[model samples]
Target: MEFLDEIKAKFPNVLESVDGSNENESVLLLKDKTKIKRVCKEVKNHFDILFMLMAVDKPPKIFELNYVFSSYKTQNILTIRVNIERDKAVIDSISSLFESADWEERETYDLFGVEFIGHKNLKRILLPEDWPGRPLRKDFEVTDEVRNWTGLDLKF
Candidate 1:
């Protein structure tokens, strides 16, 4: 059985859709955030490496979390996307499954304000703890403090 077919069979309820240009670059949309770790573990057991994890801000209230897994053995790249409401942007932590997810999740949390539930050390990785708001959010505005500190007269 192929990877995509296997995953679809295993997680029919969790998987929302499957898309890709070819077999090598398939993408899966997982509907539930709670099953993220389980899905990631299955992918890892198949020799797929968690290469990237990032968040995308979909304006007007949706945040998309993207996780990219690459299998050197099969030369297959699979991307998983999960969409959550911006007001309640929370998702399970995959740091336990992939160590690299620690920093990646923190960065996503710091910049996008997406909470990685169950993260051992869920704190800011790039910006300071006192940072005003999530910089990567679509509605983020430049604070007067930042403008004063930078000595710039720019408007958001």
Candidate 2:
């Protein structure tokens, strides 16, 4: 299934995206967050299903957001992605447009700590409310319970 042609036929400004196949798939890097929602809807409306959502932690600065969509109509799978900055880690919510995106967005926020600006139920999906730093972050530290493990600290 020529996924790019199908996408262009459905969404005019979705940007030029490449198709990946075989036993593996590469992320379709998007220009920005706005197209993320646009491409997602186009895929669903024209094709008819959602495959999955993924969030990759890009250390020291940002997170990469990915949405995988499949069409029962065309039997093709397409992955769309966007990079969200560390400082402004929020993106417009597609939950308003797609019901399934609700839980996926929450899961991303929960694990990677990226906020969805308009997500009504954007909250920790797999972590407690009071959890300290974002565990998935590359810079996030995993301190030993026994600080004296290295025998360098005398403070109790």
| Worst window of 10 by summed lDDT in candidate 1 | 145-154
lDDT on C-alpha atoms for all candidate structures:
0.83, 0.69
**Residue-wise lDDT of candidate 2 within 15-44, one digit each (tens)?**
555555432343455775766667766656
Among these predictions, the greatest TM-score belongs to 1
C-alpha positional error of residue 136 in candidate 2 after TM-score superposition, expressed in Å: 1.0
Q: Cα deviation of 1 in candidate 1 (Å)?
A: 7.3
Residue-pair clashes per prediction, in order, are: 0, 0
**Clash pairs, model 2 backbone:** none
- State TM-scores per candidate: 0.88, 0.75
